[model samples]
Target: MPNTASALELDAYLRLSRASLGEWLAAIRKISGCRDMACRLHNGGGPVGALSALESEQGFIVCIYASQGMDLTGCRTSDPVVLVPLGGEPQIARQGGRWQPLGKLIVARPEDRFHLRLPELGRVMIMRPRTDILNNLVNSNAGLPIAECHELIDCYLRRSLFFRDHNHARQMTSELFCRLGRIAREESKSGCDCSGLDRRLLRAVDKIRHEPDWDFNLTELASYAGVSERNLYYLMKRDAGITPYRLYQRNRLTRVRYRLVDCQCMVPHISRYAADEGFSHLGRFAALYREHFGELPSETAQWRRNLLEAESGHSEEPLAAP
Candidate 1:
């Protein structure tokens, strides 16, 4: 494996400079496979900065972005991703939830959507790995040291560039896998587990997350999960502290909210969005949406409209005499 300088010489390296927020978001969409992605500038001035992406032959994609302050919203990748902040203040939230500090190596799951707020002169690294590697990281919560991970990333980039001897690159890859295995064993001992639920429950939950519009009854969900209704109820209670029906409703509400708040959505009607997610009863849907998101569905739609108006430098208020 060669150093960063040598790795940058690879053909797959892509760099953009003085790019607008729209251009940056477009590049990010291509790399992240995110849907409904949008960005809002926070710095008044253009988010003039540099963004680069490198793709390795082994299915590892690394994106490094440095820019002025902005807020970005998007769905996560179809697979999991690893996010690392190199500099400046950045915060992230999922499903319109509370924002948390983002200057750490965090795993963003596929089923989640992300709202990232990046500060002025922010630098962040987002990496997508092969499915097996990502699954291992998710299960293990490796909590690997930043320096060690950074060193390995450089090595992996070097290998992707074919910068060194073939045997050397193979050795680096093998060593990286072996280290992850050891970390998994250690984290399991320390009880740093994530989603220790049964495989059947995961199967059931995945179905609900991916198909939130489906009106699944307990029996049907249990059948799909390969568990008895009673057992499934117990599993959901123990694992998520919520009933299966509640889980389904949560996903349904999330889908409805997503549609309502989507910046690109032409029809911002709350009722239409609710019905799209199988919520036919307007009153009930509004109540559920309020209870789940702490805001009515109409409020969500209004917020998006306000954001768009602000982005377009428009205001309905009358102008004062000059």
Candidate 2:
């Protein structure tokens, strides 16, 4: 066994520049489709934070920020996010400007708006899940969003810190979501029967991610998930709001986009890469890529290349304590 306390530090600083912190914050906001946030640090030294991420799209991002007294105004999310309290009581005001203490785990549904003021010298870990995934949890646990969110995460984090590696993180994350969806059935009044259905749905979803290149039909997916087509339809409709096929397509497209942005020059041609990922129709692939990433795949590749080039010469400086 080895200690990896320092393996996941993507960026570190003693006193971070507003612009530097903004770069990291903006990336998260952009990917999560969150806009309209104004952040100000509590202390004069400025916001200091560290970020760690996985290569695949399946993993959760872990960030630690020490900027309490940091007041954020006009914030909202286009995804479902869990705001975990790290150190002390955090002040969060949502819907209205009224501030209050953040409970155990604050679950913010997609499109939910909130204003937040971090406690003095407080730290927090935030996990943002896709809106569709959150919708499933919300549909099953409508009356207990926050509590359900907490327990779902508790099941996943019980093992160990997920800073191992990308492939490990991706596999673990896949199971994590499956287990999360599995919870829906257990919490339902139907109990085991519905829980079994939930498990089937997740199994189908996992099959999609595991074999994105496969042109999986609903019937095939249902078979793989160990459920009837009718029940599969019911589960997706009742929980995820999308068909099994839709999630498969999204998994393929999002993974392609992630590779375009992450792998860079290793993937020489965008069309070839897209086709390899099962997007056979270039015209349709370009359109879907634009719709999902807010730009063409080429643009994403170029932007990511620029970031990698910039980082080739970049140096990290540990932030000094105030």
Candidate 3:
């Protein structure tokens, strides 16, 4: 599985000191091969300096930033870029370029010295493709040259970053990357052909993601994918490195996390949320929610409410136990 960590966790691991901006930049440069990277400190009450990094491995590079507003300039290898803002707003400008009003999410590719002005503490995830892997995909797909590949990537990134239809963007990008990876792998082997089973597997995965609330069983999912139950199990194990049931649980849990942490919804309504995510049994849903998020459903909901109330300058009474 791909490694994942929150920005705060990654910042502590890197040990960035607020006292010295030069030292912080040096650390980022050493670790990420980021040359000419620098940020001017924003005069705010929050932390003076913060940085986080995520190793991509076979995935795309992801960086999370949360600091006071500042002007930023940097240059890395020529690669596609996507910047997703989780909070606040910022304006992004290319080198020697005009300023563009950047709202919730922004995606751009600047060959060098991309300029950005962040006015507040903002959380943004930056994704960049592995160049060699991307090039290989292009070479293997006869119709897609390196230039066309870059354009397609740019399109995907832009749509993902800017579109209000986040569900569509996420689904499309995930499918595109998986398809490209499979094509590249097959092209490297002799006499490899795309199988009917592969199409079925992809459809099955998509259905689970798009309709998590559906009453889907192993047999139903297998039939939907146009494969037998045994073949479905074998294919999921071979391709996704997990069983179909496990994948379903993971996806459902992920939705719960997004609601609890990202959306800051209340706990009493968690059962409803779980139902929306396809959990029909309250006991099983609560058990899985607690296991995945390390807290009872009610506790998670109260925590989010407290956070929301705090953010909104409202004093909220402590939530009673469920």
User: All models: lDDT?
Assistant: 0.59, 0.53, 0.52
Cα RMSD, each candidate: 18.3, 13.5, 13.2
Ranking by lDDT: 1, 2, 3
TM-score of each: 0.46, 0.47, 0.41
The superposed Cα distance between candidate 2 and the true structure at residue 219, in angstroms, equals 55
Clashing pairs in 3: 267-301
Candidate 2 regions off by >4 Å? 1-21, 54-64, 145-164, 187-322
Better of 1 and 3 by TM-score: 1
Residue 21 miss distance in model 2 (angstroms)? 4.3
Q: What clash count goes with each model?
A: 0, 6, 1
Question: How well is each residue in 29-97 modelled by candidate 3, as lDDT tens digits?
Answer: 544455577767677343434444333234343443445677666745355454545445766777668
**What are the per-residue Cα lDDT tens digits for candidate 1 across 53-158?**
4443334444444456777787577887877776677888987799898867777886778878777667666766666666767776545555555555544443
Q: Tell me the tens digit of each residue's lDDT in model 2 across 1-322.
A: 1111122222210111122345435543443335677667666544333333332244353444443357666667656666776555677887775888876766666455876676654555566654455555566644434555555555444322212222444565565555555555354321221223366777776687567557868788888888899998888767555667666665676556545543436344888878877888899998876654345676656554443444354524321111
